[model samples]
Target: MHMTVCLVLAWILIYLCVMKGIKSSGKVMYITATFPYVVTTAFLVRSSTLEGAMDGLYYMISPDLNRLFDPEVWLDAATQIFFSMGLGFGGLIAFGSYNELKNNCVKDTVYLSIANLLTSLYTAIVVFCVIGFMGHQTYMDCLDNDYKTLMTLYPHKYGSLEELKTSIKLDEYIFWMEHQFHHSEFPLLSNASRYCNYKDIIASSAQGTGLAFVVFTEAILQFPFPPLWAVLFFLMLLMLGLGSMFGTLEGVITSLNDSHVITVKKPVLTAVLCGTACVIGLLFTTRAGQYWVSLFDHFAGSYALMCIAFFEIIAVIYVYGYRRFLNDLEFMTTERPGKYWTITWRFVSPVIMLILFFSSIIKSFSHHPVYSAYDPITTAQVDTAYPAWALFVALMLVSLALAPTPFIYFVRKFKIWKIEGDIPAASKCLGSTPSTTYMLKSEPSFNRMVESTASELQTIGMNGPSTNGSARNSENDRKGNGSNRHPPKRN
Candidate 1:
C-alpha cells in the first residue's frame, strides 16, 4: 500500500512538472542528482570500519573474474553506462536544446558522467562492506535472510573511541560470523515466510483483488534515519524520480497532443490524467496491484529501456548523420570536437548499444531458477499458468509496441490545423526589401584597394611641397641661382 502510494504520488508530481515548463522543473533535479552520492559516501566511510565488511567487498569482486571474458559482461557494462548517464534518452537532447548556445555543455557532461561513476563506486563499496560485515556471499542471499537479523549483525558503536576499538576482534567476531552463516535460523525468518505465504489470503480478504498490505507494513521497519537525513533522502528521491518521470510523461503527453487525439487544455489534461492514475493506483492495495507493478517495472524498466536506447543511438548517429550532429555539439564545448569523437559517435556507441540489446534478448530466453518453500500437498494448484513475471514482460513489450501508433497517425494528419491560411509575413518580405538585420550578399569587409586608398588620402596634398618658411626660402634660392627655373622667376 505504501509503495503504491509512493508510485502514484511520484507520477502525480511528474504530471505537475509537465504542466509547467521543464526549465522551471530542473532546479529540483540539481539536488536530486547529488543526494544519493552524499548518502553513499557517509555509508562507505562507516561500513569500512566494520569487522567483516572487507569479507563482503572480497566476495563482490570475486564474481568470476572470467565473467569479463564473456561478451555479455561487456554488454552489461555498456548498458549500465548508457542507463546511468541517461544517454540515448531524448531528455539529454531536449535539455541540451534548452541550454544557451554559449554554455560549455561538453565539460558539464564529462563532469556529470564522472560524478555518476564515482557515486556508483561508492554505493558498491558501502553495500559490499555491509555484506562483508554480515558474512554474506551475495546481495540476493543477504536479502533472503531476516531483515532484523541482518540489522543486528552490524557493529553499532555508541561508546568512546577506545571502547569501540576494543569491541573489534578477529576471533570472537569470526566465531559469531561462522555461527551466523552455519547454525542459526533467525526467529523472524519464519515470520517473514508466513507473511509471504499469506500473500494470496491477504489479497482475497481486501476490498477487491488488491495488493497484500503486509509488504508495505514490512517496509516501514526498514527506514534508515537520522531524522534530518531521512527527510533529505526521501525528498531527494522524490525530486529525482519526479524529474525522470516528468521527462517521460511529457514526451507521452506531447506526442498525444501533437496527434490531435487529445484536444483538452494542457493544464486540464495534466490534472485529469494524473488524477486518474492516482485513482487507478489505489488498486495496488490488492494482490493484483503488486503483480502488475512488478511486471511493469521489470519489463518496461529493463527491456523497454534497452530497446529505446538502441533506437535513439541509431536515430541520432546514423539517420541524422554524425557530421551534422557535430554542429549541435560545437555549441556545447570550448574545444573543437576531434576525429576520435566522430568515430565513437558514429560507430562505437551504436555497436555497444546493439551488443547490449542482443545480450538482453539472450538472457531473457534463458530460464530463471525459482525456488519456493511451499509446495502444497494433494492436488497442487499452479496459482498462475505462467509466472506472473512473464505476464509483466509481455505487457511491457506490448506497451512499447503500441507507443508509436499515435506518432504514425499524427504524422499523417499534420496538415489538419492551418492557423494561417496565407503565407507568413516574413516569407512575403524575403525578396521585397533588404533586411537591416541580415547581411546576405554583403561584400567582404577586408580589401587591399580600400586600405591603400585610405592611407594615400591621409596626408592629402602635404606630400607635394612644404609650405613652411624654410621650404619657401629654399624655393626662392633655387630661382635666384638661375637654374632652369630662373626665367620663370624673372616674370
Candidate 2:
C-alpha cells in the first residue's frame, strides 16, 4: 500500500512535469537537478567527520589487476557506460532534435560526457564513504555488545585480544568473528577481539540500495535540524530518477506521435501514457514486484539495450552509409567528422557491440538468470535463479522489445505497412542509393523552418513534411502557404 501510493505520486509528478511538453518539466528541473549537488556536498562534509569514513574510500585503495579478465566486470562496465552516457535509451537523440540546426552538438556532447563522468565519480565516492562508516559501526557494535554474549555462551581461555592473537590465525579469527558456523555452538570458537578488521568489514558491507535510507535515517536521529538534509537527500534521488524518466517518457511520447498511428494533443497523449504506465507500474508495487523488476531488468535492461544500440549503430552507419552520415553531420553542424570518428563508428564500435550482444545472448541461454535475494535467517544476500515460468515471462519481454526491429525491417522491406513516399527496400536495406536519402537534406530549424530556400535545402526530398511558404526571410514565414519549390524538411 505504501509502495502504491508512492508510485501514484511519482506518476502524478511525472505527468505534471511532462504534460505541457518541455515547458513545465524544464522549470521543474531547476530544483530536481541542482539540489542533489547541495545534498551531496553536505554528505561529504559530514562524512569526513565519521570515525572510519576514509576506510570506505576505494579511490585511495590500490587497484586489483586480477579482476580485469573477469567477464562480469566487462559486461557490468558496458552496461554502466551505456546507461551513464544515455547511449541506447534514445533520450539523447530525442533531446538533440530540439537543438538549433547550427548547434555545436559535438562540443556539447564532449562537455556533457565529461560532466557525466565526474558526476558519477563524485556520487560513487559519497556512497563509498557512507558504506565505510556503516561497516565501522557494524564492527564496533559486534565488539561492544555481541562479544559479551558470545563469551558467556562459550568461555575462551584467552579472555583478551593479546592472548587470543597468539592462539589463532587471522583466517580462523575472521571465521569466528563473522560467526561462519552459522550461529551454532562450537567448542574451539571464542569471543570477538578488540582488534577490528576494517578490511573484512568494508568488503562485506553492501552498497547502493537502502543505503540512503540508512544514512539519512541516522542523520534524522542524530544530527541537528534532523530532517533537513534527509529531505534533501531523498529529493535528490527523486529528481535524479524523474530526470531520467523525463527523457525516456518524452522519447516514447514523441515516437508514438510520429508513428502516424496515433493522433492526439500533447496533453491528452501525455496523460494517457502516464496513466497507462502508472497502471503497469502498479504491478511493480505488489509483493511480487521485486521479482518482476528483476525479470524485466534481466531481459530488457541488459539484453534489449544491447540489441537496440547495436541495431541503431548499424542502421545509421551501415544502412545509412558512412559518407552520407558524414554529409548529414556536415549539413547539420557545418563540420565534417574526423578520421577518428570514421574508424570508431564504422569498425571499432560495431565489432565491440556485436561481440557483447552475442555474448550476452549466449550467456543467458547457457545459464539461468539469477537475481539478488536476501535470506532472513542467514542475514545474507544470495543469487537465486528465476522459476521456469518467470524465465518464460522474461524471455517474452526480451522478444517483445527486439521483435520490432526485425519486424519493421521486413515490414518496410516488403511494403506491408507502406507509407506514401518511403525509400525502396533495396535502397533502405542494401544502402544502394545515396541521393534518395536524407543525407543531402537539411534538418529543419524551428526558427527558420518557415523560410527554407533552395540553397538551404541541398536536395529535393519527399519524406519530410511539406514546407511550401518556408523561407529564410522571417518568423512570419512559418505561416507561409505551400510552395512546391521546396520539398518537406525531414521529420
Candidate 3:
C-alpha cells in the first residue's frame, strides 16, 4: 500500500509537470536538470579529501588498451552510449519533433551529444571518488578488527613497547591479518581490501536499481554528516529520475496525439494515459516485484532497445531511401550531411548495431538469468535462478516489444508489392527506377506547381515589368482554375 501510494504520487507529479506539454516540463527542468550537477559536484569535491580518492579517479580514466579488443567491452561501451544519449528510445526523437520545422537540430544534436558525454564522465568521477573513500574506510575497518583480535588473543605480547617491536614482524602480521578474515564472515572488510588493491569497485557494483539505491546510498553514508549528504544525494537522484520520466511520458503522450488515436482534449488524454500507467505500475510494487523488475529490465530494457534501434536505422536508411533522407535534411538545415554522416547512417551504424544485437542474443542464451537473493535476517547472498516459465515470459515480453518492427516492415512491403503488381510488365522488366522518377510520378500536382512557377518567371524575364501585371494575372487565373491538374507536357 505504501508503494502504491508512492507510485500514484509519482505519476501525479509527472502529470502535473507535463500536462501542459513543454511549457510546464521545460520550467521544471530548470531545477531538475541543474540541481543534480550541483549536488554531484559537491559530492565530488568532498570525496577528493578522502584517502585513496586519486586511486578511484585513476581507475576510472586510465584506459587498458587491451580491453578494447574484447567484444563484450565494446558492446558495453555502445550500450552506455546508447543509454546516455537516450538513442533508440523514441524519447529524443519525440522531444525534437516538438521544435519548429526549421529548428537547427544539427547544432542541437552536436551540443547535446557532447554535453551527455561530459555529464557521464563527470558522474563517473563523482561515483568513483565515493567508491575510493568507501575502499579506504573498509580497509581501515579490517585493520581495526584485526588489531582488536590480536589484542584480545595476546595482550601480554604487546605489554611493553620493546616486546611489541621484537615480537611482531610487520610483514608477517599483515599477511596473517589478510588471510585470517573469511569474506563470508566479514563481507565488507574482505571486499574492501580487495577493492582497495584493484581500485575497481565498479566491477563489483550492482546493476539497475541496486546501484542507485543500495551501492550509492552505502557510499553516501560514509561521508561526514551522512544524513545531510544522503538526503541531498537521494534528492538529486529523485530529480534526475523525475526529469527522465517526464521525457518518456511526454513521448508517449505526443505519439498518441500525433496518431489521432485518442481524440480527446490534451489534458484528458494525459490523465487517462498517466492513470493507466500508474495502475499497471502497481505490479512492480508487489512482494515479487523485484524479480519481475529484473525480468523486464533484462528483456524489454536491454534486448528490445537494440532490436528497436536496428529496425529504426534500417527503416530510415533503406526503406526511406538514403538520398531522400539527405534531401529532407537539406530542406530543414540548408546544408547537406557530410561524407562521415552519410557513411555511418548507410553502412557503419547498421553493421555495428547488428553485431551488438547478435552478440547480446548469444550471451543471453549462454547463461541462465540469475539474480542475487539475500537472506533478510543474515544478508547472505543466495543465487536465485529464474524458473523456465519466467524465462519464457521474458522472451515473450521481448517479442511483444519487437513485434511492431517486422510487422510494419512486412505490411509496408506488401503494399509496395501490390502497387508494383499493377504496373505494366514492361516497366517492371526495366528494373528499379531512380527514386526521383517515382517521386514525380506520385505527386503530379507538385510537378504542376513547379512548371507554373517557372513559366511565370520566364514571362517576367522576357517581357519585363511593362507586361508583368497581365502575365501574373493570367498565371494566377491558370493556378486558380487547375491548381490540382498536372501541367500539359511540353514537347
Candidate 4:
C-alpha cells in the first residue's frame, strides 16, 4: 500500500510538472536539476568526518589495469557513460530543438560535457567514501561480537578466552577464527562476506539500487542526525529521478505533438501519457518489482541503447553525409569544425560503440547470462544463471526493440503493408515530411535527394524546382551570422 501511494504521488508530480509542456517543466527544472548538486556537496563535506572515508576515496583512485582487457569491463563502463550522459535518448535533442536556430550549440555542448564529466567523477568519490564507511563499520561490529561468539563455538582452539584475545596477533589462530566465525580470509573472501576489508571493498562495491538503498541508508545512520540526512538524501534522489523523467516524457510528448500524428491538446496528451505510464509503473511497485526492473534493464537497456546509438551515428555521419553535417555546423557557427570533431564523428565514436556492442553480445553467447539474485533468507546476493523463462523474456524484450528495423524495411520495401499516402491523418507523417530543405544544391544531388523522399516533396517543393531549387534564402541567417543556408524547420 505504501509503495502504491509513493508510485501514484510520483506520477502525479510528473503530470503536474509537464502538463503545460516546457513552460511548466522548465520552471520545475530550477529545483529538480539543481537540488542534487546541493545534496552531493553536503554529502562530500559530511563524508570527511566518517571513520573510513579516506579509504573509500583511495579505493576509487587505485586502478585495476588488468581489467582493461576484459570486454565486460568496457561494456560496464560504456553503460555508465551512456546513461550518465543520456546518449541514445532523444531527450536532449528534443530540449535543444526548442532553442532558436542561432543558439551557440558548440559552446553549450562543450560546457555541458565538461560539467557532466566532472559531476560524475565527484559523485563517484563521494559514494565510495560512504561505501568505505559502511565496510569499516561492518568490520568493527564483527570485531565486537566475534570474540564472544568464537569463545562459545571454538573453545578448543585456545586455552581460554583471554588466551584467544592475545593470540589474535598470531596469523594462524586469527585465520582459524575467521574460518569458524566469518570465513572471510583474503583468499577465501568474496563480496558475499558478512564483514569486508576496506581495501578489498572495490570488488564488492555496491551500485545503482544497492548503493542507494543499502550502503547509503546504513552510512547515514552513522551520521549525527540520521533522520535529517536521510530526508535530504532521499529528497535529492527524488529530484534526480524527476529531472531525468521530465526529459524522457518531454521527448515523447514533443515528438508526438510535432509529428501531428493525432489531433489532441497538449495538456490532454500529457495527462494520457503520464496516466498510462503510471499504471504500467505499478508493476514495478510490487514485491517482485526489483526483479522485474532488473530484467527490463538487462534486456532493454544496455544492448538496445548500443544498437540504437550505433545506427544513429551511422545515419548522421555516413548516410546523411559527414561533409554536409560539418558544413551545416560551419554555416551556423561561422567557423568550421576542428580535427577533434572530425576524428570523433568519422572514426572514434562509432568504432568504440560498435566494438562494445558486438563484444558484449559475443560475451553473452560465450557464457551463460548470469544475474545477481537476492537470497531473502540470508539477505545476500548470489550470481545465478538466468532460468529458461527468464532467458525467453530477455529475448522477447530485445526483439521488441530491435526486430522493428528489419520488419519495417521488409514492409516498406515489399509494400506488403501499404500506407495510404492520401489519408488526412497521414498528411504530416515523417516519411512524408515537407519540413526538410536541401544543402548541396548540385543538380544531381538535389534531384536525387528529392527523388528519395518522392511525392512528399511535391506538396511544398512543387514550385521549388520552377524558380530556384538550387538555393534557399536567409530568414534568420543575417541576424545570426549566416546561421545555416538550409536549416530544417520543425513545428
Best-matching candidate per lDDT: 4
Q: Each prediction's Cα lDDT score? A: 0.48, 0.65, 0.66, 0.70
The TM-scores of all predictions, comma-separated, are 0.57, 0.79, 0.76, 0.78
Candidate 3 C-alpha lDDT tens digits along 1-491 = 99899899999998999787766788899999999999989988888888868877877787889977665566667767777777777788767754544456789999998899899989988877866666666666655555555555556657754465456565655555556633544344443443223333444556567777876788777677999998898889789878888778777775565443355766788888889989878999999888788778767777787778888889778876899777656645669899999999999998987887787677656887676777788676567788899888988998988997777567546664232212221111111123333443454443443454566334222222221122011122222112111223343
RMSD in angstroms, candidate 4? 7.6
Backbone clash count, each prediction separately: 8, 8, 0, 0
Candidate 1 segments exceeding 4 Å error: 1-8, 13-18, 69-79, 136-236, 250-266, 276-285, 288-294, 331-336, 366-491
User: In candidate 2, what are the lDDT values of residues 1-491, reduced to their tens digit?
Assistant: 99999999999989988886555676787887788888888888887677667877863364678977555556667887877777788777756654544466788988998998999888777777776777767776755454444455555555865444455554665575565552354443333434456677667655345455665466345445767767877778898888888888877865564443555666788899999999989999888787787677667787778889888989988886888777656654568899999999999988887887777667666887788788888888788887898877887888888897899889867869754322221121112123334442332231133244334433223343222312122222212221122235545
lDDT of 4 at 392: 91
Error of 3 at 277 (Å): 2.2
> lDDT per residue, candidate 4, 281-387, as tens digits?
89889988888788888768888878878877887888767886776566445677999999999899999988887888898879889888888887778888988
How does model 2 score by TM-score? Answer: 0.79
**Predicted candidate 1 versus true structure: per-residue lDDT over 1-491, tens digit per residue:** 67776767676666656665454456656666667667657657766786656765776676667677665566556656756666645456545433344467778878988888877777667655654544422222333343333344432632443453355343443443344532343343333422221112222222111111322122222335446544644554565566665655555544343333565665677677778767766766575665556455445555566667666667667765565456545523436689988888778866876776676667655645222222357433234344766665566565765476455446434855442211111111111111211221131221222243344222212132111111011222322112221111111
Off by over 4 Å in 2: 59-61, 145-197, 214-224, 421-491
RMSD of each: 20.5, 7.0, 9.8, 7.6
Off by over 4 Å in 3: 62-73, 152-156, 160-207, 375-378, 409-491
lDDT of 3: 0.66
